[model samples]
Target: MTEREPDSPVAEPATALGRMTPVDLSHPLEPGMTVWPGHPRFEHELLQCYTRGDASRHHRIALGEHTGTHLDAPVRFVPGGADIARTPLRALTGRAAVLRGPAGDTEVTPAALAEFEAAYGPVRPGDFALVDCGWAGRWNTSASLEPWPYVSVELAAALLEREVRMFAVDTPSPDPSDSRACPVHRLLLGADALIGENFTHIDRLTG
Candidate 1:
């Protein structure tokens, strides 16, 4: 038998010799789907259907770029920043951790992140640190449209210091609803980290 080289690529098994299951993290799109306030709602129209005696079916959809469970590119806030197409894949995936918080918390504070790190482990560089405030359950409700948990500026700065590649939350925006300045968005975007907003089912993430 030949010895395997140390530098050779080894296939890492994702499961223990069993069928792997795929978890869906994206929200399905449909007509009248929930969206940010003032943003255009999604609409689905059947261009051609089997019932119409057509050979195939087709649909026409219209929605905003920042619609449900979407990633926000730097260009969203930064002038001349990278667009959605220009965003790197590594920035969106790879090692990620969800920092859980108490229900009804208005903002993710630096202390909460520290506590999470102490319980779990320190977040390494180039990792995606997500804030799970149990707000995803409020999707499509009036409370979701109102002010919900968001990332504080101090927390954004802390995450920057941790060198996180992305900051994700389960809310419409990382900043509060009433705030006009939106410092959290500017700070994270200017630091070259992407943002994921309006995520659903984040609480279901487990080891």
Candidate 2:
């Protein structure tokens, strides 16, 4: 913006921010946020806001899964776990394959993955495999999150056996039911494989 002449209102300078497309894969965390049973209740409070006459409009949110683009640390499974920040950034950020496999089929059994390997060759190490069970279309509310999709124990081992450095899914979780007891999580996390969940915008990557 150009500066105003004397006796005119001052104008702010134009910013040089470039435009970039955003693919949001995180759930918005709120007080009534939907989470797996027995986890932490998602919450956020706007302590102050610029419009509210505060220094700035900033809110503090607290929840588990942190409900969006997040990582499952190795220590979350192991005793005295490593937490999220300790892992390498390279592990979470990289080239990924948005594989379109079965849908409405939460538990990705071993048989379901056989054709994937046959079609794409072996999934190598250090590759980010974003498995889409077609659950992206159902992310409007918490009910959809529960019944979406998940990876089975066998499939978890299969991905591990295939040497996938990181495996992520679009569903809010990697299990089928609330009381599934996280068998799939244990299988994958216990083996030290990086896991990512609660991802949206998975459909955009299909084409």
Candidate 3:
């Protein structure tokens, strides 16, 4: 028999098999879901259904790009900046470092971040720095109307210094709900970093 050729090289998996746990970090999109004031509301309309004698069933959905758990692209706050389409996929997916935040409307400060690092570990470069403020539990409740927790500009700067790929929160925004300046949005987007808002089930990440 002729000698067999060497086996073709196989690509390594992105992460060690059986060592990864999947977590649902998003809220379900449905009609009348909690949304930012004055933003487009999520709508799902049936275009065809079995009841209507249609061959197939489908729906028409409409909502603003910022609706539900979503990422804020550089162009959202920065003029002439990169849009979501231009954002690299590597920036969106990565090892995440979940930092616990205080309840209510307290602002996350650099000192708070330092305190977390003192216990768990440092927030490494390129990691998704997700701040779990326990605000997601108030989704669609009267408490949601209250000002949610936010990240301070100083903390934003600290995160940037650490070279984080993404700054995410379990609240409506990194800035306060009543914020007019939106400094955190501007600062993070200005650096081409991503901002994830309205994330849920972040508490599951810690365990």
Candidate lDDT (C-alpha), each: 0.81, 0.69, 0.87
lDDT of 3 by residue, 81-131 (tens): 999998877667777877888898798888778877888888889887889
Number of colliding residue pairs in each model: 0, 7, 0
lDDT of 1 by residue, 97-201 (tens): 778756674778897778878877888888888778888888877788777777889989988998997888887888887888999989998887888888777
lDDT of 2 by residue, 1-207 (tens): 576578976435243223334577666655775566677877788899988899888878777654555778777667776677778776766556566656774566666567656766666776677777776566556656556666777778877876777778877667775644787777777877778876777767742
TM-scores of the models, in the order given:
0.88, 0.73, 0.89
Which 10-residue window of candidate 3 scores lowest in summed lDDT? 9-18
Local distance difference test, candidate 1: 0.81
Clashing pairs in 3: none
The alpha-carbon deviation from the true structure for residue 8 of candidate 3, after best TM-score superposition, in angstroms, is 19
Off by over 4 Å in 3: 1-17
> Which candidate model has the greater TM-score, 1 or 3?
3
Model 2 ranges off by over 4 Å = 1-22, 30-32, 38-40, 178-180
Runs of candidate 1 exceeding 4 Å displacement = 1-21
Model 3 vs truth, CA RMSD: 5.2
Using TM-score as the yardstick, the better of models 1 and 2 is 1
